[model samples]
Target: MNHDHHMKITLEAILPSHAARPVKCASCRTMLYTTQNDSGLCETCDEKHLNTLNFWTAAQKWEELVEMNRWFIRGDTTTAPYHIGRLWEETDPLIAQLLELHEYGFITIDSQPEMEHVSLSIAKKWHLIKQRAYLTCVLPTRHSLIPISKIDGLRTNLLARKDLLVTTYCDNTTYPTPKGQGLQDAIPLTPEYKHFTDVEKRIYTFRSTADKDKDVLTKWWEAKTRLELKQGRGKFTESRTFWANNTSRITKKGSILTGPDDGDFQAAAAMRPLVFHIAAREWDAGMEVVGMLVKMCKDMGFEKTFEKFEVELED
Candidate 1:
C-alpha cells in the first residue's frame, strides 16, 4: 500500500507584506489593521475565545483521540467512529463548519497518500485565506510487517500454531476474517490483503531444520502456545505418496520412484522420513507455528535466529 499526502490552503497566492499591514479578522468581520502576524487576533475575541496557541493546540490534541463514542450491552463493551467523516464530508453544512474551523485557526488541512476531493476542497479554501497562515500536515505512519522477534512464548503442534502477529488498517476495527487460506478460499494469501482485511490464518510454512537446537525449539513452542491461547487453531490436511513405475522403466538406478513396480505413493514416501504430517492451515496460524520455530532457534543461540519468522502488517 501507498499513501498520498496534501496541504490545505484557500488563497490563490500569498504575497509578503510588511508586518504593519492590516487584515480583516476571519471572524466577526472586524478589521485587524495595524496588527502584525504575532498579534493577528482582535481585542474583543482574544478575551472571550482561545487564540492561535489554544485553538491549534486543541486541534492537535484530537490527534490521538481515536474514540468517537462507546457502548455496552450483554456484558460486552465497544467503541465507534474510530475515524470521523470520510476523507471529506460532501454536504455544504459540513464544508462550512470545516471552513469556519480553518478561519478560526482551529484546524490545518493536508493532502497525502490520499487527496480526497472533499479534503482537497477544504485545502483550497484555506489557501484562499491568509497566505502566510501557519500550516502543517502530518501523514499517518504505516507499518508494513510485524516484528515477531519482540514477542515471546511461541509454540505449535501438527494441527495448531501460535505467536503470529497481524497489522491493522483504520485505527479501530476488528480484522474481517481468518488469515491465510489458499486462493480457493475467500481469504487472500498476500500479506497486503492479510493486513488490510485482517485475515487471520496460517500462510507460511513451518518445520524444523537440522541446524535448530533444543532451546530454539522451546521458544518456538512457547510462541505457538500463545497463539493457541488467543486464537484457537484451525486445521486441514494434504496427502501424497510416491513409487517407481517399473525397475525396467526406471532407466536410472538412483531414481527411488523409478524402480520396477515402485508405485508413485511409495516413491514419494521414501523421499522424506516423516509422512502424512499435518500443520497449521492458515497464514496467521502458520505464523504462530513459525514463531515457535523462531523462538526455539533464538533460545538455542542459532547464528541465523528468526530467519523463518513471518508477520503481516497494513501497508
Candidate 2:
C-alpha cells in the first residue's frame, strides 16, 4: 500500500449507577457536593480512610501480586507517571470494583481520567493489520505466459481471486476502506507497451525484499535467455525494463523503494516478500490488544467479529 492507514474501533461498556455517578461519599455514605476531596470521600472520613485495615490489606495484596508477576510498581506521589500501582488497595468499594474491572480487561482505566470515565475502549487495529496482510497475499508476483486470446480471461481471473481472498479472510463489516478499494488501490495497472505484433500483454507487479530469494532471479534469468534466443535480443528487453522500473526493494530496516539498477526478475521476487513482512510486523504489534479483546469476549459470554480471526492463526 502507498499509504499507511491506522484505523481504530473502540469498544465501550455501560457502568452501574453507583459507579457512573456518585451521590454520596464512598466511605461514610454522606452526601457529596464538591470535588475538593480526592477519592470521593468526605473530609472527616478521608483522613481516617488511609489508616483503615482494608486499605493496608489491599496494598499488601497488590504488592504481593506484582511481585509474583515479576512487574515493578513505582509510587506516583505528586508528579510521577501514572501506573496501576497508584490504585493499590483503594478503600472505597465502588473504586475497588472499577479497579478490579480494569485488572480483568473489562475496562481500560487511564490514570488521567476520572474513575467514572474509564470505560473499555479496545482498538481493533491489529485485526485491520491482519486484513491488510491477507490482501497482500493475493498480490500478483509470479509471471505466467499469456496468450493474445486470453488477456481478458486473465484479468477476470485476477479480479475473482482478489474478491474471494478479501471476502474470506478480511473482516469487511467494519473495514474502514470502501469495498473493492483496499487492495485494488495498491496493485495499480502497468502502462501499456506494444509486445510483438497483435500480442496481448499485461504485467502483474508487487513489492519484494532484496537478497532473500536468489533462486527466483535465476529462474527468471533462464527464462529470459531462452526467450531472447527465440525472439531476438531486444524483443524481451522492454518488458524486463518495465518490471524493473515498477518493482520496489526492501533495502533497509524501514525503507522500500525501486532501486535504479534492479532487474525485472529480481524485482518480481522481492515484491511479495517485502509487502508480507511489512504487513506481518504491523499485525504483530497489535496482537496484544487483540488478545485482550479475545479475553474480554470470552468473559462476557459474547462472540465478537474478531473472534472469527481464527483463520489468521493458521500459517
Candidate 3:
C-alpha cells in the first residue's frame, strides 16, 4: 500500500492569541477568526473539511509516536519493512490510530496470529503513505480545508485519555443531551462514572454547540403551507442532508432534497424557497451509513418524513 513514500505533515502552525482577529472571509465575507487555521476560510466554510483534516492531523502524531518509540528505523535494521509486534494496550491518540489501522487491514498479521495483533512497521508506513497522500490529493485545496492547530491539539489531549468526555460548558451554549435518568435531568445521570454509594459525583457535559438552524427550521416546518410543503426553504445548509457529501442531492428526487438537475437548487436560489428533509450524523472514515426509511413520499412534508425514520430515543 504505497510503502515507497514518506508522510509529510504540512498542517499549519498555531497562531498566537495576540495575533487573533475576526476578519471577513475572502470568498464569502463571513466572519473568519484566528481560532481557526491562519488561512482565510470562514468558520462555516472551514468546518466542511474538518473530518479530512482531523484524519491527517492524527496521522502526523502516529508517525511522531512511532518514531519516538524507536519501533522501526529505516535503513538501520535488516528486518523487513513490516514488523509484527504485540498490539499496545495504551489508548494514546496515536496508538488508537494504530489500532484503527489494524481494524482497517493496513496492519497485517501472520496466518497463525494470536488475537490478530498489529504490524508496527506496516502501521507506521501507512501513517507515512497517508500523509504523503494528503499532500498530493488533499493539500492542494488548503485554502478551503486549512488545519486548526488549536483544536487539533486540544482533541489530541482529550482522546489520549480513554475516558474524558467533558468537564464544563459555557453556560447555555452546549446542547442539552438527555440524561440517562430522565428527560428533565431531575436525577442527572452520568455516563462516565458509576455510583457505588449514596453519592457519585459525576459530570457529563454536552460541549458541542446546539445547531441554531434546527430551531428556525423546526418553526418553519410545524405550520408550513401546502405551497411551502411542495417548495419551501426550511433549511439552507446542505451539510445537514448528507453525511460527508452534499453532492448526493443530485441523486435524490421527489424527496425533500429534490434533484440538483431539475432546476430545484437554482429555483430556490432565484425565486423559490428550499426545504430539506434533514438528517445529521457525526462520523469519520470507515463508518457505515444505514438509512432506515429513507424512501420519499412526495405528498408528505419534510417534517413528516423525518418523524418516520432515523430517530434516536428522544428524536
In candidate 2, what are the lDDT values of residues 1-315, reduced to their tens digit? 111343221111110112224356554343443332765654444443332212222222222221211111121111111121233332222333333322321222221111111111244111100111111211112223212233233323333431121111110011122234323233332223333132222222222221222211111111233344334342211111111112222111221211122212222222221121111112123222223323433455432211111101000
Total backbone clashes of candidate 1, pairs 3 or more residues apart or in separate chains:
71
Ranking by lDDT: 2, 3, 1
Model 2, 149: alpha-carbon shift in Å? 4.9
Give Cα distance to truth, residue 253, candidate 2, Å.
Answer: 21
Query: Could you tell me the TM-score of candidate 2?
Result: 0.17
Candidate 3 error regions (>4 Å) = 1-4, 11-51, 54-57, 60-187, 192-315
Span of 10 residues, lowest total lDDT, candidate 1: 66-75
Q: Write the per-residue lDDT of candidate 1 for residues 1-315, one digit (tens) a residue.
A: 122433221111111112234555333233343432343434432322222111212222122111011110010111111111123221222333322222211122311110111111322321111011011111112211222221111212322333211111111112233334321222222222244322122222122211111111101111123344235241212221111111121122221112123222221222111111112222222122223333443564434221121111121
Q: Which residue runs does candidate 2 get wrong by more than 4 Å?
A: 1-152, 160-192, 195-261, 264-315
- Which pairs of residues collide in candidate 2? 207-271, 208-270, 208-271, 209-270
lDDT of each: 0.21, 0.24, 0.22
Which stretch of 10 consecutive residues in model 3 shows the poorest summed lDDT? 130-139
Across 136-207, the per-residue lDDT of candidate 3 in tens digits comes to: 000010111222232233323332332211111111111223424222122222233243122112112222
In model 1, which runs have C-alpha deviations exceeding 4 angstroms? 1-27, 30-38, 47-52, 55-137, 142-315
